[model samples]
Target: MILLRNLVFALFFGIGSVVIVGLAPVSALFGQRAMIRHATAWTRFHHQLVRWVLGIRVAVEGERPSGPALYAAKHQAMWETLELQMRLDGAAMVLKRELADIPVWGWAALRYGAIPVDREASAAALRQMIKDARRARAQGRSVLIFPEGTRVAPGETPPLKPGFAGLYGALDMPCVPVATDSGRCWPRKGLKRPGVITLRYGAAVPPGLPRRDAEALIHAGINALERRA
Candidate 1:
């Protein structure tokens, strides 16, 4: 039954995604705001599918960050990636270079204002990310980044990527560290299970702390829920 539900959800989800991406040209004709609206609608479609077909739901804890701030979230599954954007009411997502290279979808993401970083480029990538992030900030958008760089299992706690610190320091924005149990319901691979995925937003870490201090606070904050379990 779960398998059948997942298959159905995947089919609808895939079709919806293709349709949204297919309309990118039209959305682009209207400008970047239109493209972002299209992207948000696509995310809503995904959420509905997750709820109606997969029987999964999200429960957010604590106050959602407002205004221009840095959202540093734990990486567990693809679920939080979309959810965070919606909850933040449209943020400038910092993503990997490879994801931004995926033909039409990638082009649409760039049009919608995602900042892509090339991990292999190290220092250069950090510089480029800060530059892009500054542009996003100037445009009055909060920046959302998964500091861990890649998704991990529910219990795994990995050190954040160096780029996170660089961006944090450069952006000079208060950081909201978000923790989630998304992996419990949505695994990186295999069928997603039906359950409540709790997103717990920690207190905002003030900007301008030393790099080591900021990283430590963010690491502990994002792993707070996991640590208790």
Candidate 2:
């Protein structure tokens, strides 16, 4: 039953995505942001469908970060990204610029304050990301950072990248560390795994002092999630 549902959704969204991407650029030229908004909302709706398809329930723990704190989280699965929109009243993600190349969804993300980073971590790329993030935060949006940069194998912890710590250092706002193991069921690629994913939101690290301190604290988050798995 789970496999069948996953397959159905995969087909439906996969095809629909093409249409949204194709139409988005033209819509943006006219400043018609509705399509992007629809795509964003649709993607979230799609995720809910995915949850039902796989019979996976997601539960978030602890308090959601308040104010413009840098939100650092584990990157074990893509589920964490989608779940944020529905879970938080206002949440933003620091994602790759390639996502912005997509049509409707990318346009909507820009409209909704999503920060896009460069693929190859370079000084210029990081600078652009920081600039974009700062702008978004100035507008009063919470930024979410997946410090590992890439998804690691289930139960494995990747080295915490300096970008997270650097961002933490540059921004004097509080930082929140969250942990999860959604990848055990949902492989990075292939059919979605069955059952609900459990997520634990750890406490916020008050912003002060220097950046190196963030590495230890962020690494602790990576370790904590691995322990949960």
Candidate 3:
């Protein structure tokens, strides 16, 4: 039954992507704001699908930040990626260069202000990412990134990737760390289960701390839920 539900959800998700990408040019014509709205709508659709079809409920704790800031979130499953966009009202997402290179979808993502990082390029990519992130901030959008760089299992907590610190120092914005238990319900490579996925927003770490301090704070913050579990 879970398999069937997942299949149905995937089908609709694909259709939704095609429809949104197909309309990207129209949204782009109006400008970036319109494109962002279009992307937000797509994320909202994912929320709806999760609720009605997958029987999963998302519970968010603590207040979402209102102003432009950097959101460093736990990377457990793909679920939070879509949810963060909806929750942040289309904050600029930091994603892989390959994902941002995908044909029409990539074009739409760029229009929606996604910052793509070439993980293998190290220093050069970090510079480019910071530049793109600042551009997004100037546009009044928060930047969302998974500091760990890849999804982990429910109980695993990995050290954040080095680029996170570089971006944090360069952006000089309040870093809001988010914790989640989505991996328990939504596995990285398996049928998603029906359960509650909680997202807990931690206190914002102030800008300009030493790299060690910032990384320590964010690492603990984003792993809060896991620690409790």
Candidate 4:
């Protein structure tokens, strides 16, 4: 079932994204913002369609931060990245430097204003990311990050690197921790499975906490998921 859906998605998204990207010039020539918006619309459509076709239901747990907050999520599947784009409008994601190497998808991400970061040189990169994130917040765009840094299977916890705390410490933004069992459905290395994926939003850690304290808060957030479940 998952293979069938993936084949269908490949047939559509592969052709569709190329054609959608080709629409860029229409806006460029016409001097309109429609090109970028159209691409986002297509991506949003792809996200919704995947959920529908693969029988994966997404459930949200917990509240959205009242103000612009840094979103730290568990990395699981590609769907998580795609759905995060649609889940929050104008949201900027902190993706790997590698993703920027992709052809059409990378260009589309740049067009949509997604922020890519170098996970390897994360310490030095944090400053620039802070600037980009703040700019996005000023533009009413949320910044979502995958704190775990890499995709891991569900029913397992990956040791998180200190990137989240390092970034948050410098910027001192309100950081929101979200836990999701998305690996159960759209796992990192398997065909899609039919199941409900839970996204549990936890408290927004206050700003100005020391780096160590901030790190603990984010770690505790994931631990909370285990306790609550």
* Clash numbers, per candidate: 0, 3, 0, 0
What's the TM-score of each model vs. the native?
A: 0.97, 0.84, 0.97, 0.85
Best by lDDT: 3
lDDT of every predicted structure (CA atoms): 0.90, 0.72, 0.91, 0.72
> Which lDDT tens digits does candidate 1 get at residues 1-229?
8999999998999998888889898998898788878888988888889998999988888886567899999989898888777778779999999999999999999999999999774887889899999998998999999999999998899999888999899999999999998999888889999989889999999999999999999999999989755
User: Between the candidate structures 1 and 4, which one is better when assessed by lDDT?
Assistant: 1
Question: Predictions ranked by TM-score, top down?
Answer: 1, 3, 4, 2
**Ranking according to lDDT, highest score first:** 3, 1, 2, 4
- Please estimate how well model 1 matches the true structure, expressed as its whole-model Cα lDDT: 0.90
Q: Write model 2 residue lDDT over 23-108, tens digit each, in one string.
A: 66555565424543544665676676766666778776677655667888787777778766555544668888898777656776
Clashing pairs in 1: none
> Per-residue lDDT tens digits of candidate 4, residues 88-173?
65468888878877886676566666677886755668767777777777777678888878887665676667667666865557
Model 4 weakest lDDT span, ten residues long: 27-36
Q: Which stretches of model 4 miss by more than 4 angstroms?
A: 24-36, 223-229
TM-score of 3: 0.97
- Cα RMSD (Å) between model 3 and the true structure? 1.1
Candidate 4, backbone clash total: 0
